[model samples]
Target: MGTAPVAVPHLPVGSRLLVPVLAATGGSGRTTVAHLLARGLAAIADTVLLDLSPRLASSWPTHLAARRATGLAALPPDQPLTRTAVRAACAVEDTGPHILSDSRAWHAPPLLNLPELPAAWYQLASIGGWQAVVADTPHPLAHDLLTARHTGERALTRDWYELPYAIPVLCAPATADGVHALIRATKTLDAEALPLARTVVALTGTTDGRLPASLRTALAGATDRTAAVVHIPHDPRIRAQGQSTAHPRPRTRHASTRLTDAVLSAAHRMWGRPMPLAPQPAALP
Candidate 1:
């Protein structure tokens, strides 16, 4: 499908917003949510999409049709990570946010024995002068935290969730198993005393219409614990072709807009100040 240039919003005076979209399981639409959120925010401000998924499994490179393989992994470890260096590492998209993800060939040897710390990536993004950074995180720490046996390991993993600038966008599918996993994930967060008051829950619809009555009941109880819940409509194009830069259906676009508005609202309420308004795109008639 063809793409158009993404509209840039008027510059707003405020610290950059970091949105980390995370999920506990695969097929939870975490990456999709991150993509849409970044696209929406990119229309409102200068935004960057940071793909933190493992190199072999990453989708950003393919979805964005990035021409370069250079990304976070390509940055020289010895050099100071300045804004210019970070910008140089990104793959520019003609119709979306700058994408920073490992686009190396699948057959290439691994560059590092371990992934870079989340803090380092966040710091790099913070200094890049973008108004927002939408991070497609690998997975939630709840699962790893449950299996971790050592106190030090758990502490280090838990620290990843402690970013003050991050606004969490917890994603899950609108299905029985997905809802159940979300419950467990939330319970783990509560157990760790992590903040949820600023979280935005995204429930992606796999089928048409409302969720099953039983699932809705369970989801309602779970959603009540977060800042807000936004539903993503089922997009047949995406379901068939996977995530791409193709324009989504009207309903899906509306849902994405609602999610974006909710996130901005959460930021305003949390900081006790109104965020500079962006001229929103026209809603579906």
Candidate 2:
């Protein structure tokens, strides 16, 4: 009889992972993608969505504010508050083992000082026992603010690579002009910070399966290194749903779903583990 195969031990259900998804430009559907990815990751383990953008809190679900107040009230007056306060404030729509937080709310003028931000973030991550943190940050603004705080001791004129985390995802538009514009912008950013080519995932927005040939040619011509490209086809339901206050009906071909899959796939590859897939729900006709 053949010897029994050795079985490998399984990884704990929740392993800490930090993923930062950024846009080449504003309005590239970065926030939408970040939220969907958070929801999808929740399917696997406890996930927290941290939106570092300035206006993230205003657009967040209503219940989030009440939650923050409750958590804040519980803290001792002398002790510094952790970033988890932001997460506690958000009303979690699902009972799944996840906490989705819009970190943008924490970006108020009071929180702008760098000394407080990083310390708070570190403390929050340590205390929450979070399995993963998916952060959505404003392009240059996020990078600049965090960098200034991290290296406040150094002269501002000196070149420094300051960031709370590495950028793994770089989202861009699918149009030729968009790609060209991004390429130029990436070059400028690379001069100061890390290269965009090192991104593990590059998501492009498209209207249909048909991608612009010019954009394809430009990406091909460029020597910038990129791991993969995820095409997000335009879906009217996403926009139409956003127009109304009601929770938009989730659709099968929704752009968020595609974006989430790509992010999770990238995470799986990086961690060398299989990520659980979100259940597919039936779409309304």
- Reference-based TM-score of each model: 0.85, 0.62
Position 280, candidate 1: lDDT = 23
Error of 2 at 100 (Å): 5.4
Question: Which candidate leads in TM-score?
Answer: 1
RMSD of 1: 7.9
> What is candidate 1's CA lDDT for residue 239?
76
Candidate 2, 10-94: lDDT as tens digits:
2244455555666656666666556666665566556666545443332443335544433322334345555465456444545
Q: How many backbone clashes does candidate 1 have?
A: 0
- Prediction 2 TM-score vs. true: 0.62
Clashes of each: 0, 6
Please report, as a residue range, the 10-residue window in candidate 1 with the lowest summed lDDT: 276-285
TM-score of 1: 0.85
Compute the lDDT for candidate 2.
Answer: 0.49
